[model samples]
Target: MSSQSSTQGAALAPEKRETFSSRKLFILSAIGSAVGLGNIWRFPYVAYENGGGAFLIPYIVAIFCAGIPLLFLDYAIGHRYRGSAPLSYRRANRKTEIIGWWQVLICFVIAIYYAAIIAWAAMYCWYSVTKAWGNDAEGFFYGEFLNTADTVGVSFDFVPNVFFPMLIVWIFTIVIMVAGVNKGIARANAVFMPLLIVMFLILVVQSVFLPGAIDGLNAFFTPNFDALQNPAVWAAAFGHIFFSLSVAFGIMVTYSSYMKRKSDLTGSGYVVALANSSFEILAGIGVFAALGFMAYNANSSVDSVVSGGIGLAFIAFPTIVSAAPFGALIGVLFFGSLVFAGLTSLISILEVIVAAFQDKLGWGRVKATLIVSIPVAVVSLLLFSATTGIYLLDTIDAFVNQFGILACALVMVIVFGSGLGMLPKLAKHLNRHSSIKLGTGWMVLVGGIGPAVLAYMLINEFQAKITEQYSGYPAWFNGVFGWGLCGLLIVVAGLISLIPWSKNSKLEDPEYDQHQQNVQAEAVPETVSKEY
Candidate 1:
């Protein structure tokens, strides 16, 4: 597994893996993944609640201190090893492969429900034109659209509205997955990221022109400098940025694995991080401007109109669309942005799962895409398209994202940075080809600051979730689907990691030989262009 030869296992798997043709595509794809539903819906409220403008202080600190460092950590491993998350970690050191599988499982869980939100947004894009959720947006979203049951239990009673759209979303996802990385992911990001930016910009411009729009913008931008003294506000900045950039997950790792060996790993990371943060700030502007208009219309304060996550996307935004003039345009743009952002993120999440199987089972891209995606699509449809879906989605999302990501990330940096003693090796690998060379400070950031912050976040989340049923969901519901599902993922990850890697995957990575030689030589790669 240490060295690779093209001819070493010709019969096992003949197809060579794909790579992004340029640094530009990789940066675009990475940004597409980072700037997702969270950037649009979550960041605006987080910043508003955290300290308004002052949140940027910790947000930027968290970026340099934690976000970018972990991002580079993912890049160094994936690009240096030139394989999927499992293969990359296995090649790095065998003991660390389980961490990769844990991330893969987390992505699988996220992708399934993530599609439902995208489907909902896609439907809202149409509903915006029709003014579908008339009279009562809240009742329409829950009682009518989702059709909540009296109790928290699964049912076959599918809502045709949700079912059809979700089915369409899954089919679109399946097609994209089958198209392979370059024709599919790269091209999709190429199109969707630009479209998302343009649509959101138009939406923001329109919202800014609305009556009382300045009230929302002022509420969002006016910094409560006093709030900076609160530890929770600082934690909020770190937490939001931690999630915003999509680092330490299997996503960045898998995406980076597709980059060329001599690529500018760090430089591309900085670009992705910057674009992601900038988009989040822009989203805050648009969302709160709309919120300000909503508050003005309702004769209430901006604080009363503020909401985040599902409430912001489905309820609050829908209310804004209904009340404001040119509301239909607002609805289409806002919901349309969600669809674009969610779809791009959904693609990246599924790639983590598909790439893992491709490497582990020695399957070609088409075979792996079909084999991995179809069953997942079926499961996603069954779970998320029914009346019971909202409860399951809410509970599972809280558990996996709030608990799973931080837990896996903490274990990742600790295991890779310490247990395997791979940080020094990884740091060297990064500096060899990257434009901005890393030093001990980067290492310290990844090893020391990253873990401490993650540990603190994990402890706080655990205390909060464990202390009470999350979101006032029933204890049985939280226990089985929340804590129980999280526990199940780790168990599943350990078992999956025990499986033997196929000959083609573990035995045949020709570029990996060049990588090891580069590490041994400790010089710039021969493939490196004069640009560096």
Candidate 2:
């Protein structure tokens, strides 16, 4: 087929795009994408709630069986096709292309709110110097800083402090995006990842020396094995693994697509997985140690100071830092780490949206970066950075994560793993180029085991939603901002997918390389009907 042939998607047309300079750079970037605020704040609480130290067993199991396996699948598909999620999916099976668009849309929503959190981190970094949050950290965070209003309604009231920091966050993200992949994403990760680890390690060491550090460690590591018997504990483990790894967000798919053809897909996936999980455990230790100190001083227990999500980072940690020895320096290291972690993850999320625009519309890096980043900034400042920002952030996060992100992954896994019989083919591709070869067992994990777990998670979330509104907001609020917002994303993705693709895409050209077509041919089952 001619490269000019309109039949094949524009993504297949011969073209050169930036790639990571080396294997190490790619792996670090991938690790950076996976390591985020979630690793630091979210996972520790999850482990505590599930089974404390015992949670590691199921969490590790979920990593190999579901998380790493899916990571490999995403790597295999993207490396073979060498396109962003939308273009790559379209090339794999025309019908499944919408899945890519769905992921990108989910990423768009994530980028807007994710940056807002980063802005909080940036402001908190300065606040650390003066211990500005005072003893009542929660009160200052919710009352003075956020000036939070009723959860049921949206607030347009501008909080200039929030807006300015958020503007910086967006500016930093856009400048990095404009740098392109290697110089931008890889280089940024190369710098930030090490700094993040060092700062976090310092925090952990400082935290462990405190009077009640052992008490914090006990609460974090003491295994409540009986909790393991509950199915919800198992579910939490799997869910944490999935969320922490940054899978199903089109990030791994997009990042892997930039890999050199000779890159070790399986080995790289393993590295990223292990690195992410290891950081999570480290973060749990540091967080709990700090909380333990807080409890000791307050004449309370670890449970009193323990929290997760934004509360843990912005409120609890600040509270702990204020009363601790060398409060200024410790607070700086803690929140500074948040700044680094948040930036790396934010860029990855925004990259998905930027790549979508560039791939489908053939826009230059600068053009695509501005088009997507500006609207996101406006949304962040106006809607999500206000006094009511937390409300919108929580609602959108719940619905988008449950319905938008997980839903896309579930559908993709079902269609490709079972419907089209792509699991083995993708495994073959991974093993062919990767140093660590995969086998039939990997296929079983991805095709059967992973999807079943994901389906259960999705169903469980729905059941929980039915019984009680997520985070206990008003039903009307959940209906609009939660489900209603998610529905709008779907509509937007569908509309965007209808845009005309550039025929000049290298993937469309047979001469650029016949390998992509061969991989797709092998990936699709001949007996499968064309309709789906």
Candidate 3:
């Protein structure tokens, strides 16, 4: 299809589509999405485990090569097609619509469990002030707080502590999502991102001054260059970068769809990338310094106390809060940061799902927001309120990150590049209005190296998951929630894509009205577009 014809839908729907009011707001919102809860807990351990300070090598390489370039690709598609993930892909190419729906489903799964984590963070923020965990932080988290089940399975018994907060989270999210893009999403990021940074900075400084902080810093910065030789290190960098930057998940695509025409697409992406990486590095410094204090308190090494994800956030950090000087302050800052970060990222995830359905059904923003979000909220509440919630969360998170996200990303890149031969077309769209021009190099990195790295990471993940049980969860549980759920998304997304788009949708024979004609006249011609 010609680029002009492919992009005609966007021109027809200018009033219907909401955009970020300014480039500055767009950058802030983008950074808010990228600098998620993982930036604090997961990144520090990922850096320390992969190569300590030496991990910076592949980390930078991954961000510049895979992360930012892919960001621009999302920008191109969304900005050009002017729709949500499904609508954007449908506009880009009819056959690729399934990829977009798959993203929405992934977001759906993530939002369901993700709310629980944010609720945990909110509770922990209060617990920080009270030091509610008492003497045994780990025991309090696993036993007293969660009231976790003994085995890996689903249950109906509810935990009020989890249920209430999860409910509150959903209510707050619904309010924000219903408010629409400019009023809700942009404003929330404007509020949350700065607050997160300030709280985190104070926390980092406080942790650094605490006893044994230098030891943690040393442990973090101390490089084992020999680790660089391991392919796993590079893979770790690529994997973390992918998750960290929120690339290829229909997020950037949806967010960028809101950018004003003639916006500096690539330049803004570079800024978002830089801010995100800088935040992660800052997180590493703060987190490791506290872990060092934890090690010192235990009369042990930093390596012993070092961990990531839920353990680090819930168990390890809480222990640090109990032991470190100004511990209450540390707890508040750290946990509060989690709340802010998680909320922003969760907003982005839900937006992907909400926007997809909104565009597909051509429903009003408020109507779509309620119809989609309420059901998702109900599901999240029911599943995550149970005693078995943690078990299910852990298994589902593992599968989604490994199988769902990684596999889907690889397929999207392949289909867009070699399978459809659309890189040339995409690259042209990016360079036309973008301040930072892209040519063959951007094409090669996104189309070639990007796939190679993702393919390698996916292969490694599949091999490890297939050969061994993930997190020692039961085989049945893994098969049902983990592998089973991932496969289910693909089939469901395919079936949904086959359903005819509502006549109200842009996909249904959009008229080539005067607005579209004017847009085409102003747009750079597609005279140069061709299959790659």
The TM-score-based order of candidates, best leading, equals 1, 3, 2
Evaluate all candidate structures by whole-model CA lDDT and list the values in order: 0.88, 0.85, 0.89
Please state the error at residue 266 of candidate 2 in Å: 0.4
Candidate 2, 241-263: lDDT as tens digits: 99889888989989998887667
Candidate 3 lDDT trough over 10 residues, lowest sum: 508-517
Q: Which ten residues in a row have the lowest lDDT in candidate 1?
A: 523-532
lDDT of 3 by residue, 420-479 (tens): 888888887677666777889998998899899989988998998999988888889999
TM-score for each predicted model, relative to the true structure:
0.95, 0.93, 0.94
RMSD of each: 3.6, 5.0, 4.7
User: For model 2, what is the error of residue 315's alpha carbon versus the real structure, in angstroms, after optimal superposition?
Assistant: 1.6
Lowest-lDDT window of 10 residues in candidate 2?
523-532
106, model 1: CA deviation in Å? 0.4
Clashing pairs in 2: 11-507, 12-506, 12-507, 12-508, 12-509, 13-505, 13-506, 13-507, 13-508, 14-506
Error of 1 at 436 (Å): 1.1
